[model samples]
Target: MNLIRLVLCVCAVFGTQLAQADATRYPLTIQSCNRDVTFNEAPKHAVSHDINMTHMMLALGLKPHMTGYSGISGWKAVTPQMKVILDGLPELASKYPSVETLLNANVDFFFAGWDYGMRVGGDLTPQTLTPLGINVYELTESCAFVMKRPPASMEDTYNDLRNLGKIFDVQDRANALIAHMQQEISEVQKTLPASKPRVFLYDSGEDRAMTSGRLGIPHALIEAAGGNDILSDIDASWTRINWETVVERNPEVIVIVDYSEVTAEQKQHFLETHPALQSVDAIRHKRFIVIPYVQATPGIDNVLAIQTLAKGFHPQ
Candidate 1:
């Protein structure tokens, strides 16, 4: 009987130790766009790429864990709250890092999308780095094959943040962040107009206009802000469309997507001077609302984009 009791006591101790190890090391597995990735312990040396992933890390207060990052255009694109966090970190590259650069950084983990680093058949692809003891995670919205859904929603933001929280063992912070975002979104929703405005999203183009379509996040943001996207019927995310369509639809408000190279003013000038667009009511009245190109996509900045658009639509 004493021997049996001893075995029970040993089992209890072992179980307790196992639980403690889990709490500390955090053995976790997450299914990404194409594969299942497992982490025996949180990454000590990690690198993030692009504004979307970098902003998420900052929001979670995980700066200490990140050793390096890349792909941010400028301080102008970054929110002030995030800029303070980014100012203290090491920048690996102004754009996407080369495979050699990433390897030399001794990085154990990478946070980037397919376009950012894991492009098909590229040297920095997840498939290439996985064998080298490096783990790569693609941004949720950037996953196109077998994982993406048409018309992105804010829920994608919540789920992505929650996943990151799980990986870093900071689920509480993620939950709080999500709750705050929801509250901000709710406040914007309250100020929405009774009638949804017809919004034309002009990205940039002279010969053929490039614009957001049904699969893009801008379509979802416009709907959330109580505006109807004239090109929401197009199935692709970003596509080139004829100016005749713009002239026919005649959007009430022109939403100019501001980027680093192409300023919002340039796009506005193009629309204002376009021979075909002169008859459009938005052009006639010069009703223009500008949003940073980064904010129009899937990211934490989307709520702010919604709020800005709401005010533009309902200008009280």
Candidate 2:
């Protein structure tokens, strides 16, 4: 009887500690795009911009806190899995939401980034929204566009997760997710070969190739998968580059960013038949790896992207 009573007391104490550990203090300040933003309390009504940012929020179980999402239908359709997860939630806007749109929805928090949803000096920005009682959190990877930032790493994705977890009082869940991703990446690294393939990311464009630079998540993904981004030295994110440079670099493999705007097959066909790229190794060998736009972006699917790239780079 005494042992049972002692066990019950210990369990009660343990539960209390767990609750306390996960509890967030109010009026917390966090860094966002080189600026300090403070939250008085967990936001009950939040909106995420872009599919990748929405995925991050959902992966952390922040759907209940979210009012709806935007910037998806304008670019890509939500996957069937995401459709089910967002059954009743409305799509606030097909593209970027106006301040009036957010105001009408009564959202207190917004999760977006430069070029992801809100553009620099655009009408819908932190400065424009903050005055109307809405708080904004910028995606870490997109910070490169607005400020001087180091080349993107997996740590950038992890940092966004950590910050979101803190803001939403879900640190425990965030920590567990981070741990799982880290473990998966480490396992992938264990199986990688010593030789890193020279890879180029093909986003789009008929006249000029739109590719990822060091500031983009694809650079980190390629590196994690034992491959090097041919344009890693370029100080830009997703930007247009002359096809001549691509021919000069002579990439061993091409990573195609598949999206609704242009079909991957079409992009592959263009590269295969292009007069300038006829001699390119990727086209000559027909070595191309197609990655979903969401996977290529900064989100939970980044780990899966790395795994896919690794297999494509080293099939043996």
Candidate 3:
């Protein structure tokens, strides 16, 4: 009964638009600690908290409009062009900043990456920020559900670029970028041979294996790069598992999430020192690629992530 009320409430909030399931244009809502709203019109003075969300905005040439970025990390993987755009935004914090800091920046818009980090930082919700004339947008990919209907796949990435193009009013640039990305995806598609190699997405936490989802951007990148996600059975987007499972799956390639000043040697040492992991196929074959934490989400970095993984998977 409670579940039904929640569903009814959401449907009412988004309007009866879901009734026409076929319609592409409809309101979408994300439930962070609080519900954040997105409008059909353009946003100025936008503040992006999610790196991928920020990258999406940057792709639309919206960086100049971005007031400040919360949790500003992953400056390395950004292409020179994108980095040039990002360098302009002030670093508010390594992760989400305090509510007072955000208010000080005078942001008119708020975009959070995942509900976890942002919500954990404080009560920085749309309800709290809206009265101050700031609107919030949370990434749909970060929603914490298995989604009975199929989640967005690579095909949807192109469609999303078009949809985002409309929202940002960068239709021309969006179309051109999509054309270039599609061409690249096509070329790489031909190079990949038929083999479903299980892969591990290792984050540099040093304790448990914090990894990607079975269904979202990380999984898509793995498949796009011609590898299978070892943890694809887990429905959640981000998960942490034990070495027991790591040894059990024994992935062929390991994509390590490099952060801070952790060098390539340090990451390899973690794998090499672990007696259980040393014999793993990935370590045995020396198949490891350091994926920057930024592209871990769904954004411009995703394209580069696929390219990086493709190189590691099929090295010279």
Candidate 4:
């Protein structure tokens, strides 16, 4: 009798947990880029854009929910690990998918961001898709491109995960992931030294320096790793500034964003050889930290980016 009672108790606990997991009601409304998007039901066929956005979906175990992905192969190659996780999912487009491409796929949802895949006032925006019965979820970090927002922080990433969890009725998985990330970041913070190094992020640009400003994910990663973004004063996210401005700031460490478009070594060589940047402290000392493009963006790889930067900034 006692054994049966114990079994019933265990079953009841799990049953209650499952019920909570499926608690999200229909006609759910969530905010995306300062707009309210209502979902009559959880998206059945969805598409995500960019490596980072795809990483977010995969981390949430949304593979079964996703129909395809886009915006990766055009600029970045899928790493071996990511390819395995993708599990033969189709690439609807090598770059940004046109409205016809998405419409033909018959997808109900699109996960993209301003400038990430959908440009502001572009043909593939939420306004354009909504009429065609597709719901759009804009990345929180990219929200700054369309509206005024506070400085970038880890919470922005957390909020994305949380919102995705709610959207998919997988709040439990989302909460657990957020908790794990928070714990990881806290552990890293405990080991960090008191000194904060001045850091510069070099994404890609020749005549002018393309880099992250206060609104970009790199700014948050730099701060978390006990480093200061030299261009934190700029209000834009990813924008171009003159090389003269980079020379003026005199960063102690330069972070090269690694992608297929430009190799990290090539970018480092340019900085090392540039006549104007010769006097820069980072260039003089050869203090270059190469971070993969995915890690530098907003995704599960953010924790790894912080760890990599912390080690690079203050190597023991």
Using lDDT, give the best candidate's number: 2
Per-residue CA lDDT of candidate 4, range 187-264, in tens? 888999889889999998899988989999999999999998898899989889999998888999999999977789
> Which lDDT tens digits does candidate 2 get at residues 216-251?
999999999999889989989878899999999999
Give per-residue lDDT, candidate 2, residue 255: 96
Q: Compare candidates 1 and 3 on TM-score and give the better one.
A: 1
On the 0 to 100 scale, the lDDT of residue 147 in model 1 is 51
Q: What value of lDDT does candidate 1 attain over all alpha carbons?
A: 0.76
- Clash pairs, model 2 backbone: none
Question: Given candidate 4, what's the lDDT at residue 125?
Answer: 95
TM-score, one value per model: 0.85, 0.93, 0.77, 0.93
RMSD of 4: 6.4
Cα error, candidate 4, residue 34 (Å): 1.0
Candidate 1 residue lDDT tens string, 171-277: 66666666666777898898676898789998888998988787667887888899988988776666789999999999999998887677888889989999999
Runs in model 3 deviating more than 4 A are 1-41, 73-83, 115-117, 120-122, 145-152, 155-163
| lDDT measured at residue 104 in model 3 versus the true structure, 0 to 100 | 82
Candidates' C-alpha lDDT: 0.76, 0.88, 0.65, 0.86
Clashing pairs in 3: 71-95
Q: On lDDT, who's better, 1 or 4?
A: 4
